[model samples]
Target: MKQDNITAKREQEKRIVSLMIRTYCKGRHGTRQGLCPECQALQEYALLRADRCPFMEAKTFCSNCRVHCYKPAMRENIRAVMRYSGPRMMFSHPVLVIQHGIESIREKKRLEKENHEA
Candidate 1:
């Protein structure tokens, strides 16, 4: 595959991972609980995107700076796509679920491969 295709595919998978994190955080998942006032505000700001995240303050801190806390280039892509497509994904595409599932499985395999190689 060409370099651009790899980058684009990585970008899409990054979006999928980010979506999973947000959804997991929103619902019951891990054993841990509680969010700091800053993280809480950040979460809401993340959801409504009303303002910048206090915990991750800056309009583009993670992705722009390539923070280790987030997968490289993912934060921006997720923010951009969700900002535009969240509602559309809900009502427009009937294939959204299947597409997401397949992408997720691929991402998991990719991660496993990378980990094994490392």
Candidate 2:
């Protein structure tokens, strides 16, 4: 029972981390520091290096710097625990749905503001 609980918790964290990565790729601004126009271009170029590379230049800062950085370790840690049941859980687990959904909503607004002013 205890082991199962741990897996469930990790799986949930996996979803949240997935959301964060999606947000980064979908949201970064042109003039934003560590992510200006040239930086963004670099990120586009770095995807090809993901296989044998330590860091993709495009996502290097976000992956390395601890500044709101979403480390891969978090995914490894939580995913090992959660064993996700898929999107259906969003309905089955109302609390997780509400929390992650709200966070995504607020972040969407924030990113919208950034995109506009950029």
Candidate 3:
């Protein structure tokens, strides 16, 4: 049961990231259809990172993770994509945006409580 939940969470995360990348590519690269090559590559890299993330079971999002596994360049690229697409997501994917926000808040509270206890 726990494993199923983890797997579902991972898939959900991948789906959200893919949507963000596609949104970024379409907005920035003027791609009417599928992602541009660069965006596709970044999407793949992000999925790979998520799949192999050691903290997947413990963390709500990569941003909340204490350890940064993405390379510096890739991290910056993702940051740019998020910055561009995050606000737009409210229009294109409001449900996902709300869910992500709730999860992030929960994670923040969890971490703060953990720190206080420690």
In Å, residue 85's CA in model 1 sits off its true spot by: 18
Evaluation by TM-score, superior candidate among 1 and 3? 3
Model 3 stretches with alpha carbons more than 4 Å out: none
Q: In candidate 2, where is summed lDDT lowest over 10 consecutive residues?
A: 54-63
TM-score of 1: 0.32
Question: For this target, which candidate reaches the highest lDDT against the unseen true structure?
Answer: 3
Candidate 2 achieves a global lDDT of: 0.42
Q: Which stretches in model 2 have alpha-carbon errors above 4 Å?
A: 1-86
What would you estimate as the lDDT of candidate 3? 0.91
RMSD (CA, angstroms), candidate 2: 16.2
Give the better candidate number (1 or 3) by lDDT. Answer: 3
Measured against the true structure, the TM-scores of the candidates, in listed sequence, are 0.32, 0.31, 0.94
Tens digits of per-residue lDDT for model 3 on 51-90?
9987777788788778999999999999999999999999
Report per-prediction Cα RMSD to one decimal.
Answer: 12.1, 16.2, 1.1
Ranking by lDDT: 3, 1, 2
lDDT of 2 by residue, 71-116 (tens): 3654343233233432444655667667756766766676679689
